[model samples]
Target: MIEPTMELGGPTGPKHRPGTLQNVVFAVRGQAAELAFRDAVQG
Candidate 1:
């Protein structure tokens, strides 16, 4: 399962490429969780 990556050119293997649909969802979920954690700690 080769996939494009930002670390280097070409599809090296399984990876989360920036701007891809999967990455977008993962980034959103991660950021949401991070913000929730921050609020829990600071607020």
Candidate 2:
């Protein structure tokens, strides 16, 4: 039930682009997995 938000690169250089959909998806999934692992460890 985790709702991830997309982060667009601002005027602070061009470290992050806005057209990489696959990267966004992978990032979210990695974050979700990390969170889940932490929760399981705590529980």
Give each prediction's root-mean-square deviation over alpha carbons: 9.0, 6.9
Each model's TM-score, in the order given?
Answer: 0.53, 0.57
CA deviation > 4 Å runs, candidate 2:
1-18
Cα lDDT tens digits for candidate 2, 1-43: 5433233223321255545776656666767777798899999
- Give the range where candidate 1 is weakest over 10 consecutive residues by summed lDDT: 5-14
Task: Provide the global lDDT of candidate 2 against the true structure.
Answer: 0.56
In every candidate, how many clashes are there?
Answer: 0, 0
Instruction: Please give the distance, in angstroms, between residue 19's alpha carbon in candidate 2 and its true position after superposition.
Output: 2.6
In candidate 1, how many Å is residue 17 off?
Answer: 2.5
lDDT measured at residue 8 in model 1 versus the true structure, 0 to 100: 36
